[model samples]
Target chain A: MITRTLFAGFGGQGVLLMGYVLSHGAMHKGLNVTYFPAYGAEMRGGTANCTVTLSEEKIASPVASNPDILVAMNFPSLLKFEPTVVKQGLVVLNSSLIEESPSRTDIDLLQVPTVELAREVGSERAGNMGHGGSSQGQGKVLRTQP
Target chain B: MPSEKMLMRGSNVVGEAAVRAGCRYYFGYPITPQNELPEYLSARMLDVGGTFIQGESEVASINMVLGASAAGGRVMTSSSSPGISLKQEGISYMAGMELPAVIINMMRGGPGLGNISASAADYYQATRGGGHGDYRTPVLAPAGCQELAELTFVAFDMADKYRSPVMLLGDGLMGQVMEPVIFPDFIDLKDLPKKDWILNGCEGREPRAIFSMLLGQGELYHHNLDLQKKYDQITAEEQRWETKNTDDADIIVVAYGTAARIAESAMNDLRAEGLAIGLFRPITLWPFPSTAFRELAQNGRKVAVFELCLGQMVEDVVLSVGERAEIYFYGVPGGVIPTPAEVADFLRSVAKGDGEVGRRIDV
Candidate 1:
């Protein structure tokens, strides 16, 4: 089955990097994939996102509308993308910055305090890594923790 | 074992493909959404024993292309929307002189200096002659990264074979997107036909003139007719398109470039709902697979033309269908692309004909 993933956050949050790594890994597995940045005013530190689609068959569109997985690294990203998630899809929110939880009940929500977890490990900037690990675990990609 | 694929950005892939296609000369001005292309080729061209020049302006870059092509070199230039406008003068000159050159336009938002976003708004400019001439530029619109590279590779040959400028039309998303690509082997320039029209230091051969200026009356007129005949021959020979589930579909989504990819995804979503929706993607924007439209019209399938521009390609669709089928248009100007789900929703609503499809207008 094709899985559509959207990683949304402010610029410099490694949102694009996360998507890129995922796409790379997917490609190495011989799976069809596409990774594209949301290209507009993204250099100015507004909401930045990248969409990645991995499928056994050829991917039709690189831009995901109702992504099966939504990774929001900021509060605005969560608020913006939460409504677009498919029912019963997973929403991985960076709860360290976003104080409120998503109100949707149909989908499985994981309020991952990536920043707090990374800080506990002594480097707060490794929040993206923490989130990436959580995503891999949820997506059924076997990997050891860094 | 299968060839290992490299995860490459679309712009850099285009550059690599051009180099592999035996492009020995590169000239272009830096433009956003496609700067990576020229930047990649700048260093890489030298490795292949090719020349690269970052011209001062788009106008200068295109003129450089004209000069290189006149010298019978396989050359290329790239730009975005606004920059493409500046290159039009040189492009027209290239057409008038019947020189072969490859031009890449990673189109962005348009009209003026619109914005650096993925847009197909320059459809008219790319397919039709943006320059002042009665000529048609061959345009190839690639929807994905693989096609992005492969089309650029073929564009060089098309340009050389026809002795006219060929355009590879892409958008910002096409430039920025990353996908797996296996670079083809380098082309041997020796295998290609010799260009006898080149101005290589006149020695023992009669002097040849490659000028667009025609002073006598009816001279330019006949030249225009000859160019038109050449364009007609190209149109008759080259037309590329792809159809997905079109044979048994009730509605057909007609789109090109990046917009067509989005529409294909939406078509899949609709297919999941048991809706009989299909997609007709024109790989060549010019010589735009009008036969496909005629067949769709004959099949009596409703046509929905989606574009990133304010309905530019819709005009061509109408001309092709010509009351053979009802034509509906949905477009978003200024580089706003609808998501797949949004497109599916629009198509779903429109297929029923109960309501409009996202501001749909009947033509």
Candidate 2:
């Protein structure tokens, strides 16, 4: 089985770190994994993202135009990648930051109050983990949090 | 005895390996994805009685390395894509003077004004002699943190042995990735072969001038020819590669550095699918392991070259095969890297003789 996920948000939102953690977990599970980040100016306050592919076999291109899971931590991320989610794919959005939800009928959209869940966890930066776990519950997306 | 293992970034691994190899001087400017190298060296060099300088610019850094090497000390400098471009002139001069120094390039995207993204776009410039003049620098490509450490030591050894500049070519991902690295046992610098050509004030000996300039055309031509001879010797002796499951394989995938690591994963996937696919990873980018590739191609196997840049190393692969076998290219440009699955897919098609041409995957 092959699972690909893209996490996108503002630079300091820990989107890249989320991807790193996910990739590391996948590798630890004995899956072949590749993680690539949007570097350069895109990392400086702009929309930053990372693409990770975890597979039982081998992963081909690390670039995923249509990801199996799209974790959007901000409004721009949701708007930019919402259209590229695979059919029946899961889209996890941070409800606190994204006022409008993706209305794509082909994909399952989960609107999670990620910031609130993170605050409940005693760490505001755990928003990505909150969204990641919530989306994993919806299906197909692997449980990435260790 | 086994070496000690340490959790290190690929860049710092290179720096540490250089120190272990008896490098006494380091000069570099800070660059993203590789800044940790000079930063780590700043402290480590002090322990070894070496010197580390954060230069004003990349040009100054390379020149400083050249000066230190000229003074009979093993020296090194490092930079990323744009910074490397600025140091090309000094590199050419170093090569001309036959100075022994190691230069590390944590490559990023580029033609002009490219950013801090991992890309092998500098392949042509690095392997084909980016610096001017009829000269060449031995380029070593390391796929992972382990190779990053080992190859750094090799780079220093090769520089001193050949009395020429050596380049350690890595990318942004390689620079930043954390891995367990085994540090080599310390070798006594005094035990290494002496460098008589270095200018050490020439006290009581005939004055030795170290310069690339030759006034006469014949002398210049002779110098270039001598350099070519050395390159030819290196090509014959120093080509390094790793071959996985090539025997009875139908498709041989050629890749180097980080791309080779992805290819290894992809090769495993193709093998599980009952397809005959093997991986050929070049550890020495310049010498290129052409002999092994030529032998593989002559065995009537199809070749597929994968790279992060458009058809750079593929051209060399084709030349190595010498039209004895059909070759294909799969490239991902603009700071993109193909996943192992994608590479497996390409390999499967090639093995089946599906005849699918090159394609790009946007992430």
Residue-pair clashes per candidate, as listed?
A: 0, 13
TM-score result, candidate 2: 0.82
Question: What TM-score does chain B of candidate 2 reach?
Answer: 0.96
lDDT of 1 by residue, A20-117 (tens): 88888888888888999886554768888988888888888888888889999998998989999999899998888888888899998888888889
- Runs in model 1 lying further than 4 Å from the true structure: A42-44, A119-124, A141-146, B1-3, B358-363
Question: Best by DockQ, which number?
Answer: 1
lDDT of 1: 0.87
Say which docking band candidate 2 falls in. Answer: incorrect
Q: Which candidate achieves the best TM-score against the true structure? A: 1
Model 1 chain B lowest lDDT segment of ten: B354-363
Candidate 2 wrong stretches, greater than 4 Å: A1-7, A18-36, A42-44, A51-72, A75-95, A98-112, A121-146, B1-7, B31-33, B43-49, B186-193, B204-206, B216-218, B341-345, B348-355, B359-363
What digit string (tens of lDDT, one per residue) describes model 1 on residues B33-87? 9989999999998898899999999999999999999998999999899999999
lDDT of 2 by residue, B1-363 (tens): 336555556788888888888888999999887888999999999999989999999999999988998888889999998988998999999999999899999988777766677889888888888989888889999987777988988999899999999999999888876555678877798876698887888789999889989998599989999999999999999999988888878888899887887787777767887888888889998988889878887677788889988879887886687668878778888776666767777777676666564642211
> How well does model 2 score by local distance difference test?
0.82
Predicted complex 1: DockQ: 0.76
